[model samples]
Target: MFLSTFFVVFLLGVGQAQPEDRSKGLPTSFPVPHTDDMLFYLQRSRNENTVIYDLNRKADGTVDAGNPINVYYIRFARDGKPWPLKWIERKFAYGYSHKKLKNQSGFQIELVAYDERKIELIPS
Candidate 1:
């Protein structure tokens, strides 16, 4: 019984000793962007710049039927301001296309670069 307990404790200790994966090695000092309509953001180890995804809303505060999400970049490495992606970046990197569901439930989003994984956005 004591041997088994010791082995279990050792395993737990080893697990705790492992370093945590910190946002794919993003710098901890980088400031996280925030906005009222922001849904989420993606960061990369390549640079401090961040990609922001925000809900596109109408004047009445409802989700836009045609364009439901706005994707842009927060250029932290530059002046820390939001900027539209260039044509090349939009075509090859972070651009995405979304389609409203036929069932009127939500929008189906597919990344231009990585289309194998689909993201569904449902408004509350």
Candidate 2:
């Protein structure tokens, strides 16, 4: 009886899944099956000891091209400055499809920065 109860409890514990984390300030993954005017992705970047700390996608000419987005990339020049780049947005280059963003493709967005240090991505 005790063994059976333990097995049941174990199964229940496994059933209860953990929530996804995305608090590292990393950009979210881009959408696949990219439909019209879909949110590609959002992320942060670094530069050679300097961080660009600014972004402006609409101004970056990355505005939805209707399909096959360029997925423009961006870096930083802020050695010890804030992020978000000079404008409001940056481009994406590559990545995996997110479960939350299933069917969405990964855009290649490079972050130009002088910091040299690499950053990781966290889904939000």
What shift in Å separates residue 103 of candidate 1 from its native position after superposition?
1.9
Candidate 2: lDDT over CA atoms? 0.35
| Best model number under lDDT | 1
Off by over 4 Å in 1: 1-28
Considering summed lDDT, which 10 consecutive residues are worst modelled in model 2? 46-55
Candidate 1, residues 1-124, lDDT tens digits: the string is 9999999999999988968776785666767898999988888877889999899899998988788888899999889999998898878888889888788689999989899999989867
Instruction: For residue 50, give model 1's deviation from the true position in Å.
Output: 0.8
lDDT of each: 0.87, 0.35
Model 1 CA lDDT for position 38:
97
Name the weakest run of 10 consecutive residues (lDDT summed) in model 1.
Answer: 21-30
lDDT of 1 at 35: 91
Supply candidate 2's per-residue lDDT for 13.
93
Structure candidate 1, residue pairs in collision: none
